[model samples]
Target: MEEVEVVVAHSERATLRVGEVFLKVDADQSRIDVEVEAMSLAPVPTPKVLWRKPPVLAIAALPGATLGRLGGPSTGSPAAWAAAGAAIRKLHDAPLPPRTGRAGRSIVALAAELDAECEALVANGVLPGDLVTRNRQVAEAALRPWTPVFTHGDLQIAHVFVDAGEVTGIIDWSEAGRGDALYDLATFTLGHEEHLDDVIGGYGTDLDLDLDVIHGWWSLRSLLAVRWLIEHGFDPFAPGCEVDVLRARM
Candidate 1:
């Protein structure tokens, strides 16, 4: 394996240049561990919300020529879902640092941010249509009785790293925060329905989470994701499809 040279550095960000690779470093802990990627850019922009404390564990680089192809399909398998669920559950159950009533930012702040993003999208000719309005209503309803649990705001397959049937590490903590736990589940199951049942099933039998609320928030999140993509130059009606399915189901 070749060692990548750290070419750019910031207090909270860095960039590494390898022979034929460019790794964008999002989080690094004391030069001992790092969360990085060789991709040209992240799929979504990081939110400007200050939520969780800096990560404790350091992520040592996994030796490989290509970091993109490191994880395989099995990461979404039933066994892998179980392992991921266990890991997520542990994260949620961990005693959260004292909530000053604002570590996660207020739901009102989130709505304001979403509205600003939506306006930017419309300005760029990416109309979110009725989806934007629907999201506002759903968000208001969901935030009424919010439970501030630790949530990996962007808990999707791409952020999970698996090896030999176990979750070796989780990447992309840029969105980590205190919010509804179900929102995390919704984000995880956004487009891939194949493993949703398994993922939800593995959430365990202890907590009595409201299914309707979860689905509602999931729908809203899907819309937000689509809007973001459109604003960033992606065609909403592209061959891959958009969040219409999620909207209809909601």
Candidate 2:
């Protein structure tokens, strides 16, 4: 008998794996809708959808292992990271999706949210005031204007699959849509700062991508994520995780 695997479970959604098929159960049908649509539209490789039944979306497992998770060692080679970067650039250059993605927040909205979260973090004693203040300063650069592009808003390393130093697939498109291109780049390189050059190499230098903006996204994402991750029973303070990412900026 094939053993079922509990991939992830939290308040908003849960994912399970049964042999070769992975089933994602989300409370929001709209997110599933976006995932299905974005996969069809994305130019790069994505998981093949097997079926969908309201809350449960079944997809075939991809051929390779993920690049790695946050707070963990990344197994992908320099070539693999670059390949992932190249794929992301292709997605960014694609036509825009109709809806706002996870990374699509306007500067005003994002700044407001960041401010609120920072206050809460300090008030609740979740993080030191100095840490939050410094990161907040670093995050300011990302609040500027940006042209929207197709983005896999939550492009974590673990979501990218690779084999033989090549990108095989990208998964978890629930956050995909029109958004800032730098947001995707920042998300992909968040905890793996050492690999930034490899990704940039694959992504190209002609685009004039700003390193400061990417770093700003890193701080912004870490600050905004700490609360939700805590609520979701995840430890943001884990080594090489969100808190550490912020601490490095200090």
- Candidate number achieving the greatest lDDT relative to the actual structure: 2
Write out the backbone clash pairs for model 2. Answer: none
Q: Give candidate 1 regions above 4 Å deviation.
A: 1-23, 26-59, 62-75, 98-103, 114-125, 128-141, 231-250
lDDT per residue (tens digit) for residues 1-250 in model 2: 9999999999999999999999999999999999999999999999999999989999999998988899999888899999998999999999898888988988899999999999999999999999999999999999999999999999999899998877889999999988999999999999999999999999988896999999999999999999899999999999999999999998
Report clashes for each candidate as comma-separated counts.
0, 0
Whose TM-score is greatest here? Answer: 2
* Residue-level lDDT tens digits of model 1 in 1-250: 8787875455566656555444554455532121222111222222122222344322334321211211123335577676666666766665553322122556777667767766665676654556656655664544545667766656766666656556665655645556677777665655554566676666686886666666666555655566655545555455323455345554
Per-model RMSD to reference: 8.5, 0.7
Local distance difference test values of all predictions, in order: 0.53, 0.94
TM-score for all models, in order of appearance: 0.63, 0.99
Instruction: Tell me the spans in candidate 2 whose CA falls farther than 4 Å from its real position.
Output: none
